[model samples]
Target: MFSHIILGARDLAALAAFYDPVLAALGLQRMPDEDDGGPAGVGWQLPGQRLPQFFVQLPFNGQPASAGNGTQVSFLAASREQVDAAWAAALAAGGVDEGAPGVRPRYAADYYGAYCRDPEGNKLCVVCWG
Candidate 1:
């Protein structure tokens, strides 16, 4: 249903560095040839699973990037182990922890997930729905 998501990042390089490994751990790869020039950010997408793309870039209107309250972008994982790996990768890349890897019973019985904020303060969630 969604074509793509582009989160504003004051520092595009920092956001990309922070997310590179996190996305890789979930089997997503950055599109190296995806530079659109003005205020464009890096893009990542699942191999063979196109349409939905994730990007980090400066605000198109030249506004400073700010984290929105209660706003988050969640990435789906393939396994519980991937969730754990992604959480660790995020931390290693300077992300702050919002939640550790484990079953979020409130979301579902098998909703294993981890939550964190990117270097730019954008909220993120990685989950594996069993």
Candidate 2:
């Protein structure tokens, strides 16, 4: 039951470019918003809804953005193949690999996932349970 998520980045434009294909592989798109303006923040919606957006931006306090060591944002994939594609897209976009796409048995037998860090070190995972 989350409404939205905003990921802070040091370079907003680069972050957006890096995430474009990664999210597109999961069928999400960058949502258009003219009012949420402040720096280069952009929101990506979950296909249909306008709210519950995901944003990447520089810090609102005008400080350098830092990644939380324990924080991770995850995107759901419709299938394991999409998870692999997402991982490849991330790496192609200059992301560092945290974990390759595979079934993480520790999480679940069907928990297929891939982990990576964005250019600014934000951790993310593309996972599939179905």
Candidate 3:
């Protein structure tokens, strides 16, 4: 029953720069033109879908970042390579490795995945070939 997701970033410019190429690699496109009134930067849209669009706005105005505050956001990949690439990209973007990429039979026999904390410390994951 979810409609959309928005995350707060202390640095919109940094977040945008980090996510642009990384998400694009997964076929997600940044919404064009709109600049959420400047300080509140906006982007984040999946490719080829006009509806059910999701956007992530940056900066929470001095509020504490809730990145890895026990919250996890997982993205699916088409193959193991994508998972690896995602992990590397995330690390390059200031993501800290929470878990290395591998199968977690406890989650599922084929649950191949990697976990990381975003710049804001939000727990994130990428998975594929599961």
**Candidate 2 per-residue lDDT over residues 1-130, each given as its tens digit:** 6888989988888999999999989888988756656766877877777666788977889999999989999998999989999999999999999999998999998899999999899999999995
Off by over 4 Å in 1: 35-38
In candidate 3, what are the lDDT values of residues 5-89, reduced to their tens digit?
6667777677777677667656677888664454466566667776444445654575644564567877777888888888888
Model 3 TM-score on a 0 to 1 scale: 0.81
TM-score of each: 0.93, 0.93, 0.81
Q: What is candidate 3's CA lDDT for residue 56?
A: 51
Q: In angstroms, how far off is 36's CA in candidate 3? A: 5.7
Name the TM-score of candidate 1: 0.93
Q: What is the C-alpha lDDT of each candidate?
A: 0.90, 0.90, 0.72
Question: Ten consecutive residues with minimal summed lDDT in candidate 2?
Answer: 31-40
Report how far residue 82 has shifted in candidate 2, in Å: 0.9
